[model samples]
Target: MNASVLPYREESLCFGPESRLIATLTLPGDHPDSALPAALTGSAELPPPHPHLHQASRTSAHPAAAGRAPQRRPPGLILLNAGMLPRIGPHRLNVELARTAAAQGVSAIRFDLPGLGDSGFTSSRLSHDEQTRAAIEDAMTLLSRTKHAPDRFLIAGLCSGADAGFQMARDDSRIVGLYMMEPYYFPNRFSNMFRTLRRLREYGMRRSVIRILQKSRFTRRHDPAADSAPVPQAAPEEGVRAAPTPQHFAEDLRSLLGRGVQIKLIYANTLMGHWDMRHHHRHIFSKLGHAPHFDVELVPHTDHVFTRVEARRHLIRGMAAWLRRIETQQHASAA
Candidate 1:
């Protein structure tokens, strides 16, 4: 398989002189002529724009629009948080995902947080919350000034970036949809641990396990022969945490569902109970119960980064299918 270098345009937009963000608008150079028709005809459901969704008083002038049914490019702005270390999983994943979205007639823009990337300082230098909020504002401000106000906007992130995306959608209803790859929540781990303890009686050697745990001195050595039983560990993914109490994650979920934003979250199932444990799937699903506006899908046999070629391919295909479904639903509703 050949990996093509994505082509993009660079522009700087500032919410404030000292608080500017930089982004690269990238797309595949050799998009097929067939994609336009597919994009327009692919009848899929689209979550309605939030009341706060904004658009510029302008129209697009791209070639595809000239011969189509008022085709408007879907523009997405990706914001990365500076609070975490830069890694390949998210950076490469976004690059590839953005390129794929663009090939399918979507426009993607990714920028560094205020103090991260090419912008300035480390996340520790400033308030993390403030930086995330400012990043969202910057992304939104950029979307408003696009050649054509983005007909659709999707926000995505990884780890701290995912946290930032969640906060952004909560704060700004303009973000119609959210695609969080893996959101890292630290406190969720202890919750899972306690829950596991409650089920200890199911295992015959529960007393022995507790004894071992109580004696921290004996825990220093890893005894493969200690027991064939399983132990709770952090999720093995790049950025994930153990499950949190349903009540604890309720605020974030409410923030998302309260604004009526549809969420499409994808993660590796194997990451559960490990370093990247994320057991809020049921909680999120229950919170969104009976809400026709939301959809969720999980991809198995893939790691957080989607390093496997097949995993990446599946991820892209799933995204395309979801987008098409949304479009179909929107047209049918109008008719």
Candidate 2:
């Protein structure tokens, strides 16, 4: 909310075996206790130093070691790639969010997953979910070496990245919160109807009705000959199918809430294919209405990728507000 400017520093970091990942760490230079190791400076061309450098720098820059009382480390925030768009996010959204968050005392990292952006491909034969979890763990390990030594973290992502963050939070206890933007979800009947009406209103009723009638006819007239000719056995479906049913997703959310993990689900108005508005979530996941830790926010007049300038500004403000609220709540609980 304050327009005050805070100085910050940025450094490129490489992690994982042979330094496979290329990540950028941003710290609030105004914070006396916030300092990064020299080895993490510059670009991926600079090979990471020994593990001892992490420990030595962490110890020397720690507030307690400097004769001051140990300060509680703010929860680190990690921004993952939205689909394959890279860590900068659509229209450099992640970069702006990280810089704004840094000014509020929240250190942030934006990184590419293996084979995305500037990061190297992962040689592991594991599934995508496994690879995502490993990538997040490596990022956490790197963050732990900083002067803050943040014990807890928040992971934010859009679309596929949001899916990865949700799965990771489900598996790892260190992940305290999740910011999911336009995450994949199955549309319920009410959601479907709402989307239809919204489209009709936006595209003019006559055109929408014509399109819907045409689509219905196409679906009903599926080639009878092709249907009868498909005697060959088909291979089993590979790769993850659509996300679980709404009930199952609700169960997962309940489990996370039981673990005291906070979650924020943001839906762009333009994301009518999956979700349209707040009630869509309530309609899909009835139990979510009772979960205080889970929240759903709707950003009106914004596309899924948030490319417009006003949309980007609204997103950044929403993110900053959420981070500040969570940080304050955590500090209060600790006190």
Candidate 3:
């Protein structure tokens, strides 16, 4: 795909001194005077703090320039993920989202978690929880120092990153909106496990299940052509349950609503082993009395990673449309 048609620019950024988070910052064609909105992706290794030397340099040079031209810092949209995969599946999705958002005047960013990508290795330094939250905090701090400080913040996540994104929305009042794509909250490698277990159950080959997981890793090895994705031998035992009740989607939504933040969650329509991810999504959202400042959407025929180019585009377009709606409402309300 020709990338030049995309609206955003890729940038290298860090939140703090000990942090090595490489983020892509995208700005609207006309920025600064605009109401800034940011989107962030989640990562497993939280980013440490860093100074906005670029923003600082501009400010220092403009001591006498005050309202002269006003720094046109871009509104931000951040992408959060636990780690980098072999291919840029999620990264491509986020970049497309940023491009679409920028077309409509929203700035977007997608960054590697602390230890991933060009950032220094803190890879296994923090738990998924700490890393995710820290990434959000870093994004917020960066936003604050930019020309668009105080602009509303929007966050988006995938898989474990989504789990952390929800946690950040609950903890931070400044986050005005959230979008989650294919949140992997199902217990264990629920979908894949279910598929494998069901296949084993039907064939009455329970013993072979372990062997399959072990052997599959060698054959799969991150190949896009592999029929079965590679799995680590030590990859947590199959069918293991997730801790803390998987952060009930409803509860997370309620928390965001209570703070007056809008949240949109999208789940993949795939069976997670014995568990149906779609059913879980329904169970969580059906009980909500009024959408709880949250909206739920399901993307058909898409997997957790959203690797297919068409699927990625669809996800990005959906996000762009929702963001535009939110911006329109905010503008109308302000007017």
Candidate 4:
């Protein structure tokens, strides 16, 4: 029997001052002339811009544009480095995702930030945070040129990468959608209670008690908790940052939603507790799903990086499906 195959064209991208920044661009293989994507064919109609989304006059820092129909060009996808991981991402999830997207007629790029992977730091004297954003901006410029001016693009990231994507989306109008894995989880009293009860149900009192103690000890020793990313210099990939207070995180999310960004937040049961947005956030919003622009998903038995094959497959499928849905909705809105 022959092995199954997926088609794509992959190339290395080296940009920025001294060309120190490195990235991989994965473009879809040749499409049948008869079945080119709408972006290529110039068939998608541009919808009227949302007044609240972006002003025609000025540019500044803020989340992505309001949920506006994308331009004639299909949205380019930027797969950010997961935490300090290189472009390959945890378990090569970024590679797999880029391939999947290429097969679906989307272009995807995975790159490393300065001090991570093969990418060297820029010569600029900007602060660390400022440099990171500047590097990303350079990537957008280069990627836009390669893809020939995509009207907008999507940013998908995990952990620290998720944070980078979120910040850039807020500042750049070209970012139209975000897929964040294990992003900013703020548990409340009810969520804490639910977790305790869930632990009891799963392990029973005796084992659950032992497990809790063991986990506490484990966290103290190795400390993989979401809030505490180890600070050792050698292990860059282990880095992560805790989000700001729940109030601020909530406000950020709402602002992005109002701007018409389509956000998909996925939480996993890694060391970071099984936090579902429904449990942690439903109380905050009148009805969590009432917002049409965003959705939250909770996945079980998946580690933070999705090491397990089936778990990772599920994650990829959900992402691809969400991307398709967003495009479909944009087309519908334009119609």
Tell me the TM-score of each prediction against the true structure.
0.61, 0.75, 0.67, 0.72
Query: Model 1's lDDT to the true fold?
Result: 0.54
lDDT of 2 by residue, 190-280 (tens): 7767767778788998898788787785657678798779577655433353476667778788888889888888877774633445445
Model 1 agreement with the true structure over 1-32: per-residue lDDT tens digits? 12222232223333322444445544323323
lDDT of 1 at 71: 46
* TM-score of candidate 1 relative to the true fold: 0.61
Query: Lowest lDDT 10-mer window, candidate 3?
Result: 38-47
Better of 2 and 3 by lDDT: 2
Clashes of each: 16, 0, 24, 5
Ranking, TM-score, top scorer first: 2, 4, 3, 1
Q: Once superposed on the true structure, which residue ranges of model 4 sit more than 4 Å away at CA? A: 1-6, 33-71, 189-240, 271-279, 283-289
Candidate with maximal TM-score: 2
lDDT score at residue 91, model 3, on the 0-100 scale = 45
Q: List, residue by residue over 271-314, the lDDT tens digit for candidate 4.
A: 33544554566544443347877887777787778888987898
lDDT of 3 by residue, 1-335 (tens): 22333333345555443555566665543323222332222112212333453332212221233566543333356667643541123646666666677666666666666666665655456775576566666666565554335355787777655666667767767678878776645444355667766567656776776667677766656756555756555555233424345446567666667777777778775555224644555666555668535676777766667756777877877887787777766766566
- Model 2 accuracy (lDDT, Cα): 0.73
